[model samples]
Target: MPTPWRPFASYNLWLQFAPPIGQERWHCDMKRGFTKARSREPLVATLLATDTTPQRIGLLAQRGVYEFHQDPLMLYRSDAVTKVAEILQLNQESAVVQERVISILKNYYSNPILFGKNIIKLSRGDEGFPEPILIEQGNYQFNLFAAIDCIFKEQDGTLHILDFKTGQTDFDRRQAYVYLLAASFLYPTQPAVASFYNLENQKWSDPITATASHLNAFQIEMARISQQHQKDLQRYRHSPSEFKRIFPPNPGINCQYCPFNSICSFSELEVSA
Candidate 1:
């Protein structure tokens, strides 16, 4: 009646397992263990449910953009930012969130990047999980998830997959590759390119395209990550006490910002002092 469960892979999972270029210093495998492996546990579940400030800002900013496009005329209004803030209830958020989100709304109002484009899809950012693209490569099968923010058609009839970002995180080309891979399956006939746009600074990345060989290589990589992650999870389940070993911790200054720092045994949040 229903399809059987399968391992999953996504840009987020890839980032968790392997940090982006130059960001390896802050990558912590144990954080992924707590997030994906032990997430069902009461304590970990509670911690995971909490939305950090950055997460909140990103969500609200995306909603703001969604609201603006909902009523195109609203974008032309002088009080466009104010109206979007009310819809987002930005006032209820912390001062920091309110300030940043309001600025993002203002930025979008002034520029409105997608204003006249043929936008086919625009996400509200709270749409939970997207339907996965089932990928079967030889004996390995897994679900590939790519939560694309927006997809619009270019004048040349190319499908453009645009991802919205916030804060200071650099654009990781791997994410664009994942989207391209997903697009290959979802819109096989259409030529596609992917790029990133930072809502806060209004920065745009160059459009990224891939060859058949590139997509094939990425599929292989995703298969490897999916299999490796499942094995790690299975190992953890058999021996819960071996979490640290299964997902080794890299503790240091970065632990201060980790959501699981308070509960992480290997956290360097405190010293002998």
Candidate 2:
């Protein structure tokens, strides 16, 4: 018997039995633009096309939002509970996970009081945050999108924006810088102070001062990451199944939380043990 001629033979040789790796790169190669009509991409068309009349586009939109956010609380409201349960095969009604999700939602909903006495009112509207400013610097476009969990405005017109994080993880300086970049793009003239409220720790962190120089550096890093992601997505789309097989699994502790774990051979094997 002769050996088979497989296009990905060389790559598969090294990762024959390894688990799937990397983010799912679905429909990445389609030209950039939002489609009012249904997507023409083969994978997208296959998934979204249905026999139902008038089609459930709103449901599809909600699913898209849930996918990007990956928040279990949001998924529950979006009717993704059954789909998630099928994929992960985990009982969502489990006391531990349910309690954790409830606690997170409570914190998110109580953003204003979470900041304690440091809360400041920025805008007259219920939005709470100051009006966003649009700043354009060189080829970069920055649109500052922030909903103030808490805000404080001074007599001097200096505005402070506070964001709450329910998770125990501390905010990275890089994330602050990205916000600064967006703020600078929106308000070219105003000096803004950005702060993080850690609900779990019950502490308010020192604010990061936004400057033009800092925003420029953040913009460059953002562009680089965006380009790299696009490249990775393109490569994955060329052959998804083959690409998934070739790459060794980059399993994190979070993989256990994934909904698709039941169908995943690697995950099933781990569970059997």
Model 1, C-alpha of 90: deviation from truth (Å): 0.6
Counted clashes in each candidate structure? 0, 9
- Output the TM-score of candidate 1: 0.98
lDDT of 1 by residue, 1-273 (tens): 987799999999999999999988999999999999999989999999999999999899888889999996998899888999999988899999999998898899889999999999999999999998999988999999999999999999999999999999999999999999999999999999999999988999999999999999999999999999999999999999999999999998889889999899888988621
Runs in model 2 lying further than 4 Å from the true structure: 1-152, 245-248, 263-273
TM-score of each: 0.98, 0.48
User: Candidate 1 regions off by >4 Å?
Assistant: none
Q: So what's the TM-score on candidate 2? A: 0.48
Ten-residue stretch with the least lDDT total in model 2? 6-15
TM-score leader: 1
Q: lDDT for every model?
A: 0.94, 0.42
